[model samples]
Target: KTRQKGKKKKKNINLNQSKKQSVSFVCLTCHEKEEIPLSVVRDFDLMDDGDPTTPPMFSCEKCGGRMYPEYYEGVHGIKYRLSDIL
Candidate 1:
């Protein structure tokens, strides 16, 4: 009996990274809007002081003011605003 040798095929791996989503943020003081990465927002939320009442916030590059997500739903399903922080 004769045995045949089989060749192994290499698998094509895709190293391409997925695109991150950009969230819209608005400056509380100046009302200026900008697009920020969702990963960054999640990182900020993770680094927060364990406060579930407040959402992740950022500093406005234009006015040096506080920026919050244009539309954020907290743990209680309530939209948080600058007034909520203050």
Candidate 2:
């Protein structure tokens, strides 16, 4: 009997893939949410900026720590990173 040829391995879309799109974000610094283009934001979030495997940590202008989105709000107010859009 003849042996079958080696089969090709399928590529995993999830494991290795970087989407190239003009991602937009908003930086809630002062009193307004600044619209950030992907080109601008990518510069700040570059691999060289932080640990290659982890996201960069930045300080917040409003409160402290990181500031992005305010998905959570209670008796006080929505707490999120103003940098979330960044």
| Candidate closest to the true structure, highest lDDT | 1
Least well predicted 10-residue stretch by lDDT in candidate 2? 1-10
Q: Where is model 1 more than 4 Å wrong at Cα?
A: 1-20, 73-86
The deviation in Å at residue 61 for candidate 1 is 0.8
Q: Judging by TM-score against the true structure, name the best candidate.
A: 1
- Give the clashing residue pairs of candidate 2, or none: 26-85, 67-81, 67-82, 67-83, 68-81, 68-82, 68-84, 69-80
Task: Quantify all predictions' global Cα lDDT against the true fold.
Answer: 0.67, 0.36
The digit string of per-residue lDDT tens for model 1 on 1-86 reads 12222221111122222222556788889989988777777677667776677788889999899887866654346576545554
Per-residue error for 48 in candidate 2, Å, reads 2.4
CA displacement after TM-score superposition, residue 12 of candidate 1 (Å): 22
Q: Give the C-alpha miss distance for residue 62 in model 1, angstroms.
A: 0.9
Q: What TM-score does candidate 2 reach?
A: 0.29
**Residue range 1-86, candidate 2, lDDT tens digits:** 12222221223343233333233223334442323344544455554443433333334545444433222221123233434444
